[model samples]
Target: MELDGQRKSDNVEDVRGRSGSGFGQGNFGRRGIRFPSGGGGRGLSLSTIIILALIYFGLRAMGIDVAQLLDDGSSGSSSYQQQSNASGAEQEMKVFVQRVLASTEDVWTDIFEAHGGQYDMPKLSLYSGQYPSACGTASSATGPFYCPGDRKVYLDTAFFTELSRRFKASGDFAQAYVIAHEVGHHVQNLTGVLPKFNQMRQTMTPAQANKMSVRVELQADCFAGIWGRKADDKGLLSAGDLQEALNAAQQIGDDALQKRAQGYVVPESFNHGTSAQRMKWFKRGFDQARMEACDTFSDPV
Candidate 1:
């Protein structure tokens, strides 16, 4: 992918070294954050406040400055300093993420406008090690995920290294596909798909929910392919770029991951689709470049 002259997104939050693990430290439970009132407009319960305080002090005892993790009302606009210990390659990876995110913003905005709707851009947070998100604590082990609660994508760039070394899916486009897939979840949030699924899953059995989850993940994969189509149209994709993304989809498929980790496949627990399903949906979106073609829920995925 040639992103040399592309615009970088301003919606990026560089909270790499400023975050730590603790309950109520992210967008979900930041300092001065407010939750929905209960009963007669009551605030937090006493137990909740005590739990937060205990967690705060415990984190401090471990040499973590909890204040840095709290939202300071200057998140999107704040000028964040890059970690002094960051390597040159890591810096380049950050730039690559910004460019890829910017591309998604551009593509989605145009698509939404064409459909007579306004696109609400989602923020991307870059963190190292462990960082708090509205969804939960995001760590390297969690890879990259989009939090519908905050409409932000949380990413640990180290996952890109792991993608190459462990998954053997390496390339600029593969990394871009990872970012785009999470952003696709942000798109689902805007379209009411994510919220509906979240609500419906509350009443669904574990197996049923896993089935629904596979559809959700495949739609996101298709959405990423749509972005890849747009990027390719703009001459951003180079030779073997599409193959890189397809390989990534295959490598991270539920079947492939399960086979790699354990040695057997359990179809009942499959939530992200098999390698063929992922590749097929992605290719469908890439070939069609239409939102209708990516409807994994209504169509046979």
Candidate 2:
């Protein structure tokens, strides 16, 4: 949680207060999703463009039709000005997210290099209210999602507030876990696991698709643990940092979300695993500290 001296990642896109129209039920149909390209438009950085390319190709390979994935609008320049209003604490949190992202870049870069592959870091888009993505219109209510169609992770900072206030998971490390998990999804995409899962979804029954989703999410939790382990080895983790992340993993488990939302648990619809399953896989990654060891598909959870 001590990011005082850590390097900041340049991959963050701050689009707070930038949406001019509602992405809600009434106006959602008219919103245009932004698909990044290399030309003058928005001039997304190299990382963002590569991520988008990966997503576009991945979706295309899965027969998802990248053109169909896009919404109807274009992202010219946002009319909303950068807030002159953020407090110091909010700024600090933004910096923390950047630092955590940088940490993942460091850890994954080395791991990929060891395997003779290059790690392509994904861009993190920070938006408030609503945002346009290759996946579709997204609001804070959709939570943090890595859109495979855009190869970028979309997050609403207010979700972190909800993570603390509603989920009872509050700590810098806990927040870092969220970012790490989303990055984990990017890792899966790069490794072709995501495409495979997408292909499988076409033929899977609803129950089977949900099961695959659980495995996908649990694998991501393990990847977060792997990052935590590496961070701890570098002395970046404090005494309770790992515990905080684990608590967060448990806090957002499918069972936990369902319980919090509906006051009951439904195992069949659990797409993110239960609390125990989440905590167990995270521990597995922390103990093993390797991507190969975090394979949840072959091992029963």
* Best by the lDDT measure: 1
TM-score of every candidate relative to the true structure: 0.79, 0.78
Name the regions of candidate 1 deviating beyond 4 angstroms: 21-85
TM-score of 1: 0.79
- Tens-place lDDT per residue, model 2, 106-172, is 9999999999999998999988788988888778889999988878999999999999999999998
Candidate 2 positional error at 66, Å: 50
Task: For candidate 2, give the lDDT.
Answer: 0.87
- Give the per-residue lDDT digits (tens) of candidate 1, residues 48-101: 778888999999999998778775645543333333334566678788889999
Error of 1 at 197 (Å): 0.3
User: Cα miss at 211, model 2 (Å)?
Assistant: 0.4
